[model samples]
Target: MTSRENCGYSSRTIFAAWVQGNFRIAAGCFWNTLDEFESAVDESYSCEAAETYKQAARDCVAELTVKLNKAGE
Candidate 1:
């Protein structure tokens, strides 16, 4: 769905920002990804696909949180 497509774009943007040493930008993108997942969950509360996207978003947030902490963000 559109949510999945948007998540992919966000992931790519996050990767690009992180590789360029733009921690803030990367963090922002990660947050955006989370937001997308949250919206998807609200729109399709009982959908298995929405749950999967939410889990992926949570995993990304957890991973990025560690990196952000290390970077003093």
Candidate 2:
């Protein structure tokens, strides 16, 4: 069974919440980080990229948490 199913939450609900909270952060972080990486490499990177990376990391953590919780269930 999927983690959401194991935890008693429907996959839809889990995905919705995940999208609302974690996805946003993740997307943001990814873009931001990308920017940072680019800047580090080129020196003309956008600040937004760094933020995206940070958000992506945050989202990943949230996603992992949900997965772990489901596993525990």
Candidate 3:
């Protein structure tokens, strides 16, 4: 399943859309990052770009994966 967490931001939006199960068209900020990517997210959470939250989630998942792998070992 695909999930999304929206943060209050104006010009900077971490937008990405995709169908969960099979294959479908991906839109928004997912495949459309480099086109107009910028530091448009919230100023309080200032960082590089709008992909900050996304990268954070990815890093968390990666850590979980490594932990699970070690547990399985």
Best by TM-score: 1
lDDT of 1 by residue, 1-73 (tens): 1112243323432321133343222223243344554674557455675665566556555566675564455
Specify the highest-lDDT model's number: 1
Write model 3 residue lDDT over 1-73, tens digit each, in one string.
Answer: 1223543343333333222321221224433332222332233355544466546434433454464453343
Candidate 3: list runs displaced more than 4 Å. 1-48, 70-73
Q: Once all C-alphas are superposed, what RMSD does model 3 give against the true structure?
A: 8.3
How far does residue 47 in candidate 3 sit from its true spot (Å)?
A: 11
In model 2, where do residues sit more than 4 Å from their true spots? 1-46, 70-73
User: Could you give the C-alpha RMSD of every candidate to the true structure, in order shown?
Assistant: 7.9, 12.9, 8.3
Encode model 2's per-residue lDDT on 1-73: one tens digit a residue. 1112211111111121234333221121223332343343244334664444334444444676676573343
**Cα error of candidate 2 at position 50, Å:** 0.7
Every model's TM-score: 0.42, 0.32, 0.30
lDDT, candidates in the order shown: 0.44, 0.34, 0.36
